[model samples]
Target: MYVVTGGEMHQIDRYTMDQLGLSEEILMENAGQAFVRHLLTSVSIDEKVIVLIGAGNNGGDGFVISRLLAEKGFQFEIWVVPPVERVKGTARFHMDIFKRCGYSFIEYEANSIGFRESLNTCSVIIDALLGTGVKGNLRKPYAYVIKAVNESEKRIISVDIPSGVPSSEGEAEVYGVIANETFTFQAPKLSAFVYPSALHFGEVHTLEIGIPKIAFTEVAPQRQLITEKRVRTTLAKRPADAHKGKAGRALIIGGTQEMTGAPVLTTDACLRAGAGLATMAIPACIHPIVTQKLTESTFMKLPDAEGEIRSDVLKEEISYIQYDGIAIGPGMGRNISKPIYEALRSFNGPVVIDADGLYHMSNELHRWCEEPRSGPTIITPHPGEMALLTGRTIKEVEEHRFEYTLDFAKKYQMYVVLKGPFTIVTTPVGEQWVNTTGNASLAKGGSGDVLTGMILALVLQQHSVIDAICNAVHIHGKLADKMIETHDIFSVKASDLIHSLPRVLRSYRY
Candidate 1:
């Protein structure tokens, strides 16, 4: 699904009203009615409900919901937070009609005892507060309301996004209503798929508010949700008589004597991701230990210098001729970055630069980022690595992840996988995909190693570099999501994801 920022969504809303001939009032009616329908199915009419109305068009939705609930014979309260006069435009029209229907509303005050009592008595709270217009932190009044509503511990159904949650990604750290469920109109806010705000939105139900597909414009939106359907379609189908050689050969090069497990985990995930042939290029000293842990995949014993692979070992033309894709940097340790760069500077194939591999690349930006490459390059970097590559503070990169990632990818002509919550996959051409799979369980060790291997394997199997990376990212996260269903997030380790790959991948294969 295409994701939109608040401003982009507003453009879509305006385009529908202006170009598609769906007026503001017509759209508001459709939105409110759609929300009400979902509301009826989710909560009982006999329950004591309260619709907290704000001052925007969101208030308009609340007023329509209030009128419909009253007509259904439900005893509900309409509590307007801002003064009734502050409501204007389409919302004011709805408020007038609701009052004409003989239903009065209570004027809610911050820290009001009456409001607190109403919250305590109500079973369901209809949060029509700030909606998508919220920017930065919440004001004192709305923050107070959000805190009180949260303390009430009532079943909260947010209108559109939860109040105080920014519709833009990476801006969800502000105070917001923690709703049990949220009924968003049209497309979901970009922030809905992104976290800490994702925590605020429980089960999100996107209700169409009469906006046609054409309203999103002739061109498809650049940012999108990496969905299961997209991943399923992008995945390659094995033939009836498939052979290992045709599946693709993946090379994982990294691992010092001290960090041997990182490369081992990468090899495990690469093979599990269905790479026909897998090879780990590790320091000769660690080969004995890695071979014991990894039995199925073969190994290349690179010459070791101080327990790390010397850069001169893999710089020859013959070294990478047999492999379709190469992944560097899991457990590569810190010292061999220059040698890593020398190897990267010579080779020409689909290469995944990860872990300390990126740490190495961070030093040679002029050589790697500025120079042209004969083949595709994929970099999987967490926020810290991304900051190192871009020379920005970690906070700056986190705050503007979309911008920084896209800019880096476009400028360097490479596929950029900025790993974190809601992992973003940005192509060299500016297209972006945000994967919603995976949980906090992935925050532990060895997660990125597994993801790095998965990317390399899928890129060799799938035709489109963009599709392959996105599918790998989605499945990697989806595996973690599945693990949390039967096991706790804390208990999930990197190896567990490798073990669960078949069950998760089986569901995707036709």
Candidate 2:
């Protein structure tokens, strides 16, 4: 599904109106009726429902809803925020029709008894006051109304989006209507997936506004939301005659005396993610401790130098390991090492550099980005690591996630999984996908390692690298999403995600 900024949405809307010959009046009618259709089925509508209408196209949508409700003999009141004469164009057309149907508008007074009583008595608020055209913070009139409605404790069904919330991601405003549900048109706005903005929209359902899919042909590398069906189709089943080697081979190269459990979790998660064979190459000192937790994975016991592996020595050994994929940087410390780059130089198959391994890559990023190599390199980095890689603040990385992630992916010519609540999976090219799964339950430490393992396992399975990365990300978050369904969300741990992988993985089986 397309998740676009306000400009992109307007371009598509313009394309539909000018090229496709679809009228704005027709689109408005379709939007309002589509919302009503969804609302009738999803919510119980009773008398005393109030429609808060503004002066823009969104209010026009509200007027259409008012006319349809009255035509259906439903009792509702319409409160127009702007002077009725100010509502021009298609919106005025709808308002005229609503008034022609013997309906009248309620006057607006910010602190009137009727306004407060109407908000207090209403069972639901149909918020069509603002749409994607919102700019910066809302004006006093709209802000006051939104604040009042939010304080009313009524179920809010916002039209297109909650009034006062911008359509783009990273909307910094908090003074928007807190809708119980939003009936967005055509595609979900980008803000719906981003945090802070995402919090205002409770449950969002996209309503079709008659915009054709082909109208969205102009993607300066289009951004899309990852859906379950996309992941299902990306998944492939191994042949019946497949053996351990044919299925996939994954080598996890990381672990130290101090951070012992990181690589163990990655190895176990790799196996659970369907890696036919997983090998743990850890410092020989910690191999005994790691061995107890890993039985199926083969071990490459490397000689230790003060609790850390001798990367210079192990560079030769890593070259000999026959594997389809390698996952590096689980428990590896912050210091950059030769073996880390050597594995990148040596391995021809996919390599997932994550966790502390990302730190090593961050140190010598020029070599990785400029040098021509044999196979695909995927890096799973959290915000802080990504900040180092991009030379930007963590705040900058979080605010401009898509921009920085896409720029870094294209510049480095590698796949970057910018891990967050809504993880972004970017390709070497410009294409990017925002994962729609996962929640705060996946916020625990060590979750990235688990995701890194799943990513390696998928690439080793011989699937498209982009699809594999996206699949891994979706399922990683989905583990948390599905776990919270039966168990307490707060009870979730990163290890629990690995243990509960089957719960979500079973549904994605080809």
Q: Write the per-residue lDDT of candidate 1 for residues 331-390, one digit (tens) a residue.
A: 998875445556665566799999999998888777766675768989999999999999
In terms of TM-score, the best-performing candidate is 2
297-362, model 2: which lDDT tens digit per residue?
Answer: 999888778787776755665654478888888998755374566556766888889988888877
In order, what lDDT does every prediction score? 0.86, 0.84
lDDT accuracy of residue 343 in candidate 1: 69
RMSD of 2: 2.0
* Predicted structure 2, TM vs. truth: 0.95
Candidate 1: Cα lDDT at 298: 92
Instruction: Report how far residue 203 has shifted in candidate 1, in Å.
Output: 3.2
